[model samples]
Target: MNRFKAGEHEGVTWVRGIAGWSNFSIKVFLYLVDGVLIDTGPVKLSGILVPFLEQQKIETVLLTHYHEDHSGNAPYLAGREIPVYINAISLERCRVKTRLPWYRKVFWGNREAFSPYPLDEKLTTDSLTFKPVSTPGHVFDHRSFYLPDKGFFFTGDLFVTTHPQMVLNTESTPRMIEDLKTVLRYDFSTVFCGHAGIIHRGREVLQKKLDYLEDIQGKVLHLHNRGLSVSQITRKLFPGRLHLEYLSCREWSAEHMVRSLLTGKATAENPRPRT
Candidate 1:
């Protein structure tokens, strides 16, 4: 079943992809503003999106990252001769057609190989100009688009939830905190999150996310100094997160958070997971 919804906001059209059967199922959003389409939704939902794009005059496509859910339709758009802009690293990754995990393949589908044009620091349209901000931590090549004039921040996967129960094996909690802080310095009142939709109070939401990660990091460091193992600290910090760990097949767990805090490195034993 194809499930999706479109909403208009001050000339920006947001297309949201419904991932699963639940009403509150995780979703991915693609935004179109000023003839510029930001982030293409997953390939699985292209049946609806392709026609939707045909109705609009999209001059260019800008990707927040090369994550399948975000960049799956790049090849389709590029085939139309529409210039698709993504960071160099993300472009390279996409060119290689990186293999995704089973869960990602099932939910977002595979990203068809695409050749994306390199994005410059600034992307400008007739009515709007977006400044690409390097906000890593979610992924090394992740970026957030900021429209200073409108006070809008298109945060890719950065502020998914104020209180995230799990961090991917590749995520660095500390780096995420820094990136959150880095973006906070900008003047933005609204946040267009990749999964959570629009956040009216963008700064406040980002601050809350930063505080949560910093608090967790502090606790993990304190417990580590006390000679507590990662598992022990995880149990103390997140007691009820075991269900989430089980659901994600341990790909996302408190241990990932602990490992990020202790070493700032991803868990080497586990295969790299997507955000």
Candidate 2:
């Protein structure tokens, strides 16, 4: 099934997309401010997304990253001659189609290829000045946008939760910690998270996430120094696999979360049976 919801706050328009069944559904949010759209919701919900886009007077589109869930609708907007922007690192990669595993294709759907302009250091409109912030770690090409004057921060996938139990094999928890800290340095009151939706007292929420990850990092490293293997340390801290981990065929797992903190590298391994 597909789902869509629309709302507004602080003059920013947000649309949510849900793809899946009941509580198992995956969701992503698309935000629009000052005629600029941030992060296109996944392609799976394009039925609703398309009509919504048709009604908006979008002046520019800004992608927070190249992830399928975030960049899914770029092609739709680009075909209409609307200016789309992304980080330079993914500017060329997005020009070609994105390949995904079976599960990802099921959840987010496949993203079509489209050429996008590289993001400028800062973006401005008649009403607001937007600053493009380099906030990697969720993915190397990830970024966040900030509205200094309005105290609004648009965090892509950077702060999905204060404590994430499962992460993609490609993600780095340690690097993500740094990314969280990097953004916390800026003054912001409200956060527009891609998955969690609007967050007030945003700085406090981000700080908690940073603190949680840092504590996890300390625990993972302490256990590693005691001669614990990655698997051993993983079990010690984030034992067992989540349903999503099994669904993704181990592409997303607690073990990857531990490994990222220990060495910032991900290794391919089968999920150990839960004890």
Candidate 3:
């Protein structure tokens, strides 16, 4: 339930998320420029977020994506029709995709307490403007909020503050590469992620992640071509002989990537995890 206010920006002030939850905690940013609260953390911890928010002069909520750990407090926020803004695709995922067993498990109880969250307007702002980079892969609707003026990026779950993995349960390895490439073009000073810890040398780390992922792809392809099952290769490439523990931490779902390798479609939906 810790809250840390960031250095002032002319237009926006950031309320950064604290560190603690394995993947449960993140440094969520409340862009205080327009008084918009970006993402609301877990619902069960309403006392943690809502009361903290009550002390602020907030205008609305602009959810980055819909992971329950990230969006857990939506119900409590829905006490009134607070104008919550999010990507359209993310909104759909919240409503439909999250109901699947995989999604349900990831979100805990957000799907069950389903109430119509009041969303005022979809983000039609220019992608380049506001530094809002559409960095999906962790989830299809994921968006990375960038403050170009402030030289910061709320990377969400896109970038792992911890060690990177090729576990294959998560969907974004390839997409992460793309995101890294695109976001790297920006001169961001710091990158805040959902878990692990805040990263200062984010640009360099992002390049390293990209290099690692590219290398993993080649290895995964070679192993797959050699008739190794996805799990076999996943283990070998990840937690197996590599000592790359937590390569598939909640921040990244390596299992999904492996399934995509196995069946050519690595979509995770609350079904019994393949491995």
Candidate 4:
């Protein structure tokens, strides 16, 4: 069974849900602001989500990206003729069903294909307007919504945690650092994270995340300069084997960070160290 809780902030309602059985299961949140839904929860908990959405006067859905957890319920809304907006790249990726890892398929479920409306630079409702900020790193088409007037930022998977030990094979630490720096130039007081929920000190947390990644990159580079291999640096920096590495069958691991720092790529295969 799934579990969820809802919280309200002024005109916005934040729905936090656990996609599966455990409390430590993948947590995802959907935000509703002034009749606009920021993201839809994963398909695993559609029974709860579909009903909750039915009670809202949701005018449109502004997807942060095409990740399975974020776009899972988009097809449902589209069936109701509710326009679901997404970045062009994400729309193209979601137009066809993509096979996912067995773990992801079980935890977050697979996202069905859906036609997404092209997202604009700015989206407006009767009471609020949101500006889409391209903040890729977690994924190529990732975006964060900034409500300039309200000082709120809906960051999808951008700040899951300031110090994530394991990163997906598709994630780029360098690009993520750059995106964090870019978003910092904006003025936002609170961040509505995709999984962590609302954060009042969003800027501080983002800065910390930037600092942590840069620090790791610096360490990785220093070790590489000293003739250390990616494995050696991973052991020195991370110290112990992360359970996620084993769980993901090494698809995601601390070595990925070292590889990303040394080669500027975040793939499962490690590249030769810089000379």
Candidate 5:
């Protein structure tokens, strides 16, 4: 019943962060290194993971990002006093949005309940040997962690694996795209995204995500140039996707995908949904 399972890879145990009681939703992480627990999940499902942490005698818990699902279980993780770490940006965003990071709300349609917590440690360059790679666009504070020895990149939301396409969400930002391009040059083999899946062969998935992103952005520009309104573009080209509820949320996930095709914005400007 508990989807919280750990996998051993190159002598390191990687915990698959599963959100939601039923279907897989978000991915939180727990990395143990020589007795230090890197991070904890943000929800109660993370409760299932506690046994694993206790068994390992983990003494520290670092946060990859401060999103709700990722850090929701902090209260539960209090026993270990697993000192959490985040950049100033992550700290501020957590206070404002009341969750992990911003784009996550955009991508998943403002999912999960909120729980705000202050970061116990602000990881500065001197404190962490491995620098946090600033990868925004996804969210203003989104960062990718790099381990020089293992060639690991803990990418929170930078590398997503949502099937044919990640239902275009208003959360998509120019900053996120720019960060992705910057990460491509790094020498990392795996990326652990904040949602759905993990990419072991980072290069292939990275290339596809980039190419697909660029292609769709261009498609959006072309359709906008054709004098198509947001609603017209969705009706004519993305009819099947129009029914997705995530698009109808306050962030207008998929709706933004179409609106991007027009004004590069998702607003009520779209003519009322066709009857």
Candidate 6:
């Protein structure tokens, strides 16, 4: 099943795309400012999202990452010759089809390959100028857009929650911590998140997330110094496994989180037991 909802804050218009069963569904958001659209929801919600976009006078599209959930409809816009911009590092990644796990395909659907422009310099629309900042952590090529004039930050999956329990095996908590620190140094009053929608007290919440991550990182390192294996550290820190771990066939797990902190690297697709 698919559902769509729209809202506005200040002058920015936002839309939510809900896909899958109500119990296990996930919500993704897209925002529009001036004539620019930030993120393209996912392929699963294209029926609703495409229609919604047809009604808006969109000019340019800004992608936060190459993840399907964020850039699923990029081809749709590119077919019409709209300028779609993504991080230069991820430009090549989007040039080919993206392979996904069964769970992701069921939730967000597969993303078709599309050519997108590189975001090297500042981007501007009618009235707003966007400063593209590299905030690699959630993904190697992730980015966040800062509207200096409005003091608004459009973070894709950077600040989903203050305390994230489970993350993809490819995620690196150490990098995420650095990304958080990087964004925290910037001045932003409102945050437009791809998953959590708009956050008015964005800076305060991001600071709390940073503090929590730092605390977790310290504890993980301390446990490692004590000769604890990744599994042991995960059990001590995160305790029991989350349902998403099984749902994603361990692609999303607390163990990966611990492993990333200990090794400061992303685990493999099929991460072997550390101990």
Q: Which prediction has the highest lDDT against the true structure?
A: 6
For candidate 3, lDDT tens digit of each residue in 1-275? 54554555445455554534334443554444455566676543454556667776665666666766567666556555665656665444454424333423533444323343434333333322344678766666677877765687777677763345443344545676677888888888777665534677888887787777677778888998999886788777766433223432333445556655455443653223122
Provide the TM-score for each candidate, comma-separated: 0.92, 0.94, 0.71, 0.92, 0.72, 0.94
RMSD per candidate (Å) reads: 2.8, 4.6, 5.7, 4.4, 6.7, 3.6
lDDT of each: 0.83, 0.85, 0.58, 0.84, 0.54, 0.88
Per-residue lDDT for 1-275 in model 5, tens only? 44577787664577875654323345566665545445566545555776666677654455555545555555455535655556555554443334323444333223232233444333333223354687654544456667655676677667665222334342443444566788887887876555544567876787787776676667766776898776675566545642334533434344455554344333432222111
Q: What digit string (tens of lDDT, one per residue) describes model 6 on residues 211-251?
A: 99999999988989999999888989888777789989998
Instruction: Indicate the residue-level lDDT of 232 in model 2.
Output: 92
Best by TM-score: 6
TM-score of 1: 0.92
Error of 6 at 148 (Å): 0.7
The regions of model 6 sitting more than 4 angstroms off are: 268-275
Give the runs in model 5 whose Cα sits over 4 Å from its true position: 21-29, 34-38, 92-128, 162-170, 196-198, 242-252, 258-275
TM-score computed on alpha carbons, candidate 2: 0.94
Supply the global lDDT for candidate 1.
Answer: 0.83
Model 2 regions lying over 4 Å from their true place: 21-23, 265-275
Candidate 4 deviant stretches above 4 angstroms: 21-24, 268-275
lDDT of 4 by residue, 12-130 (tens): 79998887543347779999998789999888889888898888888899999877899999999988999999997666677766577777777777878889988867998777789
Identify the runs in model 1 with alpha carbons over 4 angstroms from their true place.
21-24, 242-244, 268-275
- Runs of candidate 3 with Cα error greater than 4 angstroms are 1-34, 93-108, 111-129, 166-170, 239-253, 261-265, 269-275
Model 3 global lDDT (CA atoms, 0 to 1): 0.58
